[model samples]
Target: MASTGDTVQNLPVEEAVARGGVTEIEKGARDSTDELRHYQSSDFASLRDEIHKEITSRDVLLRKLEESVTRLSEDIAPVKDYVMAEMEEEDDDASSSSSDTPEDGAPQDGDQETEEERNIRALNRCVDVMMSLTEIRENNEEKTKKVRGFYEKIYKASPLTSLMLKFLERNGGVKVIIDCDSKDISNLVRGLANLDGEKCAGTTLHKFADFFECKVYLGGEAGKYQVWEGLKWVDKYHDPEASLSQSLAQMVMYLIFKNRGFPYKCDDDQCEKLYEKIAQEALQKMTSGAYMDYLINDALSMKTPLGREVSLISVVPGMLVKHGSQGGMRTLQEQVPFLTYFFMQHVIPKMRSIIN
Candidate 1:
């Protein structure tokens, strides 16, 4: 009962084929979309669950370390009490011996121990036992500190941390956002233009301006990061003439400290003060010409007692000079390795002190 026009064979060959192809293409697209949705829903959910479980495990481990430290503290309390008691008893005995004139006729009690003497002996034995336990408690406290520190390092290095950082950055939750200045952007564009030998530099600044949201302003060059000190926001700005190496070092140290629980912005007043102090110290050291002079004059030439050499200058690419300013002063690229090494060696210890 169907008309010949409804049948594919009766239609123009191209038209019939075109309609069939379009239907196939549409069906394929729908299938692909369905697969993508399923993959996202299932796989992403599973991944999130895995990350949650890992975070929970790390937290449990940290909690255990805290509990161990608490138990040690509790155990050490009795030792502290016993030590105090012994000190008081010794003082009392010293006073009694010094004040009491032995009655010449009194029976000498040296052969047999008096109740007080026996008590003192017992106290001494208890003190000995407590001292041993105190030692153990101290060792455990140290180990707990070490374990907690290791856990932090592991957590910071984990993929979850990477994911969290990415999420924060994308959501504009980052405490510090460094915007490239006009001069920097222009320089970058010119450099790129030189590489490409193109006229792309003309529109580069305009394109960058249009790309960012209207609320954002980009300018200035500083080797330091912005931090939060309690309710106050502290901007640690460095010299504008600072090298790229200095900026790289600053960023690296910031990330390292951030991972070590020294977040740039925080609500805790103590943390804010500590980080602010650290930030100021870091800025001073990084920008100090005196430090550079010291590194070149003293630190670089130092050798081990056995005559084996140990120096960061040796690791740099070019031949280093010990005498002239040309040899002493390094290029921007040359400064990267030594500056990074210097920050890691000097600043990291300060950061580590707060880890516990």
Candidate 2:
């Protein structure tokens, strides 16, 4: 019986020990699971916040870009329209203007012109005038004035000034100048100096005059030579790369001696004095704003000649100058034609021998 009591007590103790071990293991597992879940939740929240912030920033950037593009397109719209209109062919205008068949008896697309084509035509007109320089000089006074008035339009409205240098170069050399402005005998003298890049094949006389004759003409005591000396640079007047515009400006300077006419082959001491006087006058006029003022005031009005309804702003935009507000560089460019006519009509007679 004593042995049976001992067995019962030992059995109870063993059962209790097993129960406690199982409970402790289950509690440890539960704590571990809860800690893992808490850590995972915190990490996921941080990742989600970062993703949301990135998406919001991208959205704001996209909106700002859209607004900037809208403003830019609006700003360029007028310029775009103007360019398209200018580039459009004249077929539409011609078809609308005359319902009657063209003189050729049928509509010809090739006959229509764009703004560029019209400019080319005007450039051709300049070529025609240049070819007829001698005949024009012999023309009667009234006819000459009419011709002058007509050509004045070509210089003012057309891109002839910008295109003149290149065009003259391609379609033969100094001949273009001779044909275009016969009255401007001044150009005859000055034009010879610029034939270095011209197509003057086998023209020994022109090359000789270009190198030797015009050198003396431009190298007078107070002329281009002295101007070069003042600038402290070697004179490149005869350099092949010399600019046509500089040659033109030099012609303007020589115009002061128009009363006496340019001495192409002459060597009188009086000619030397005249060169100095003209140089001083040019410097003073350019520095004192007189040259600019004259150009502004005397520049031709393009409003009436281009068309009945054309405005000055349409022809030349961004006119900041006060007097010639209608046309800026466009107006200044007209000086080429105006000076050409003046030199031809007024100074040619005095230097007829030089031209001949």
Candidate 3:
């Protein structure tokens, strides 16, 4: 009985030890499972935080891109406007260029008529006078006496007629006067005559005598004979070297007017026409070298034909003293002022009738 009790106790002890070992193994497994579960939960939380941060950063970048697009659209608007404006300006320039015409393409409205037109008009007006003169000359061709008598009568009636006759006697007769005064009657007579005799009637000797008379007239009324004596004295003594040009000019004027009689009277139309014809003839005669030289040298050179030297210069600033010192120089200078005064006092007032 003691041996059975001992075996029974040993069996109870073995059963207790097996139970304690099983309990320890189960506790260790439970602890490992809990540790694994905790680690997994922490890893999951960290991953979630990283993903949220990435998503928020993406949202911020999208907002900035939208703002940049809006700014770019605003900047492009002005550029588009500038381009449109430049295109419009180019179109306007093109249109203006197309409408323009070159200067050489056409005549201007304000251009003047040509010289040929004026010449044609003047020629037409001259035809009638020319025809009448031709008829008179043809009719009187064979009757030298009758023609001479007719001319004499015409000469006595009009100063211009007498002048024309005188000019016709020269080689290149009665052409120069026409050239100088085709439009003026009085100038024709004035240009051809000497002071004392009619230019048309005087011979070369008479012309010289007439020049002496003119010198006397200008010299303040020395007797005619005395004047002749004085010219003879000049010929003998003072400037025997004097040119004949001045003497010739004076003779031309005198001869031109002497035969016609002073203050040539004419009220009739025939007389007027005769005067015009005579004037034209005189002009035609005087244009030659002999007549032109005589007029220019003799008439133009006569300063104080009476033999008194007249000084014409004025004392003014900037004038050279040397110019005033010479007698002829001074006289020439005075002519300008005298002419200016005369034109202002006489010519300008008479110009009303002549102005267009």
Candidate 4:
């Protein structure tokens, strides 16, 4: 945040914010010991001009490339037509010269068939390559346009999203929420989260927003995505027991305790043993309405953490049944054909990970 003599740069955001709002950087950090100069509007204008020139050049290049490819394709069309015509001629010649066809009226020479197939595959591959290049060029052009727009919009909208993205880029496993809509930034977050060691521990919300008690925040989501650290996701309908809102606090506490080496007022080993005992007791008590009546009402009222946990897990097996249209019970087991299919619809895996 320190400045060199006669050097200019964008004002640090903290200095701008502390000045009472996002204005008056000079007054905000006026008490600073280090010398500084405001980055002049003229300098930003010059930078803008330079960046615009670069984009213009790129657009021109892309336009030229597209035209050139079109022209090349046109020039190659005659050759392609000629090749196809020659292939047809060869096929006709083969049929005439080879042993007469039977009822099927087709030649069955294995050697001729193999040679023709090789030629066709080579020609098909060449066409496929051309098509692939065309698609790449088109997509690049579209993406370039979107990126340019994103840069413009980032400045026009809030800078909070950009700040979160940079933080998450350096430190993985965090996410954030922001009011702005920028595909470029959203895509960046997705790529980061998809990278190894970057995903959150659990919760389908996909990213972190400075959720309640997670981090400090200034403004609200303004109906935009709830971002975690830098990850973006839409909030969806979820039952309280199955939702991140209900579970994130537990995850936070667990992470805090775990990071501190599991320090607590009680024995960690006993905690595990207690959970095991509860699970055993719940299984022993499983029955119809065991999910709600026996386990939840009977076990939890025993007035202990051990009692509550065993009762909680007892509800899990009941989730496997989904109601039919006429209200008959059908199992998720028969409905989900694959592990992935089950994984998406079932909360058991997420619950298991978060609970433990």
TM-score of every candidate: 0.22, 0.22, 0.20, 0.19
Candidate 1 runs further than 4 Å off: 1-22, 61-76, 85-356
Name the regions of candidate 3 deviating beyond 4 angstroms.
1-111, 114-116, 123-194, 197-201, 205-297, 300-337, 340-345, 348-356
Model 3 lDDT tens row, 115-150: 233323333223223222221212334433432333
Pick out the ten consecutive residues of candidate 3 with the lowest summed lDDT.
309-318
lDDT of 2: 0.33
Where does the lowest 10-residue lDDT sum fall in candidate 4?
320-329
Model 1 lDDT, residue 322, Cα: 19
Cα displacement (angstroms), candidate 4, residue 292, comes to: 4.6
lDDT of 4 by residue, 1-356 (tens): 56576555546776566665555555556635233333456677889999999899767754653454334324334433444454455466554554544556664657566556644543444333322322111245554443333222321121221121122232333222221223122322333321122443332232222323342111111222333332665342222111112122222323333421111213556445434443444444443334433213333443445334422432222122112211111232222112112222222222223323
Provide the global lDDT of candidate 4 against the true structure: 0.33
The order by descending lDDT is: 1, 2, 4, 3
C-alpha local distance difference test of each model: 0.34, 0.33, 0.29, 0.33
- What candidate 2 gets wrong by more than 4 Å, as runs, is 1-104, 114-242, 248-356
Tens digits of per-residue lDDT, candidate 2, 1-356, equal 67755745455445657666444555678798899998899888999899989888756744553454334324334433432343243234554455443666665665454344554544445545533531332346664454444333333332322222223223332321221222223433434322223432221111112322222121111112111233685432221111222232223223323322232214546534433333333334445655443222211221222111111111121121211222433343332222222222233333222212
Best by lDDT: 1
RMSD of candidate 4 to true structure, Å? 30.1
Instruction: TM-score winner between 1 and 3, please give it.
Output: 1
